[model samples]
Target: MNNQTITNTHRDTSLGYKLGVFGVVITLLWIGVFKFTPTEAAAIEPLVVNHPLIGWVYNFISVQMVSNIIGLTEIIIAIGLIVGFFNSKVGYVSGILALLTFITTLSFLATTPNTWKMVDGVLTTNFFLLKDIVFISISLLVIEHNKKYI
Candidate 1:
């Protein structure tokens, strides 16, 4: 490819990366804030209660408190990701956290009951969780992109 073409392609790739990070940040921020609401807390109760690893949290705290803690964690992660732009170490840590976040959410697909259903002959599951796969990919990319700086 020509030098100009290569430059354009690189620019586009960089823009796409920025957009992906922005998307993840926005999603996490929005969902994290929503987690503070009673509606979201109740909605997630079933999934959270069914998880093998974290289900015990409900045993010690009220559902709303659990949701609040999760929300706070997410907000912190989002801030970490933002700061990561300037500090590679922070970015790497945030990327790993983001990766873990997505992975944990994806796990709900298997841990949560009745997550799958046959709809019109096609087996479907909680489509919301499926997006985490893409988020996970972005998190990995974020890690790789920051590794050079670290």
Candidate 2:
């Protein structure tokens, strides 16, 4: 191959590796957050202000069980992505989940009362949603480029 072709190939490979690493890191970080952190403080109580839509859902349903189930599912998906198992399915599912979560967060922000009155407003401090968006984008890119690795 020509030098230009070689450089392009190398760049593409590097991007894939970087995206894969990002996916794994993000997966682990969320797993840690959900598994180790106090669910009440981190999710239930704070979500009232930070993610009121989710909070309302929590109030309307079995918050603890549903949250735990979701957390477990995330951990499983993350493991699959990190270990390179069924990556296409995982990538697509993860992307969908991330998108849904982001949309729900937006809905939560819109529905919450006096959302902007608090310094720790849901929209302002919702890095989880933003990070998920990044993760979803990188994951989709990695899957597109490294379908064989999956």
Per-residue C-alpha lDDT of model 2 across residues 1-150, encoded as one tens digit per residue: 356654554465665566655655576456645744455335634444345445555556465555565566556555555544324455545544544543554454455555444465543544443555555465565455444333
TM-score of each: 0.90, 0.52
Tens digits of per-residue lDDT for model 1, 30-143: 999999999999999998999999999999999999999999888988888887666667888999999999999999999999999999999999899999999999999889
Candidate achieving the largest lDDT:
1
Q: List the residue pairs that clash in candidate 2.
A: none
Point out where model 2 deviates above 4 Å: 1-12, 15-24, 27-29, 32-61, 85-108, 111-128, 146-150
lDDT against the true structure, each candidate: 0.88, 0.51
Clashing pairs in 1: none
Q: Which ranges of candidate 1 are over 4 A from the true structure?
A: 1-13
Tell me the lDDT of model 1 at 95: 96
The local distance difference test score of model 1 is 0.88
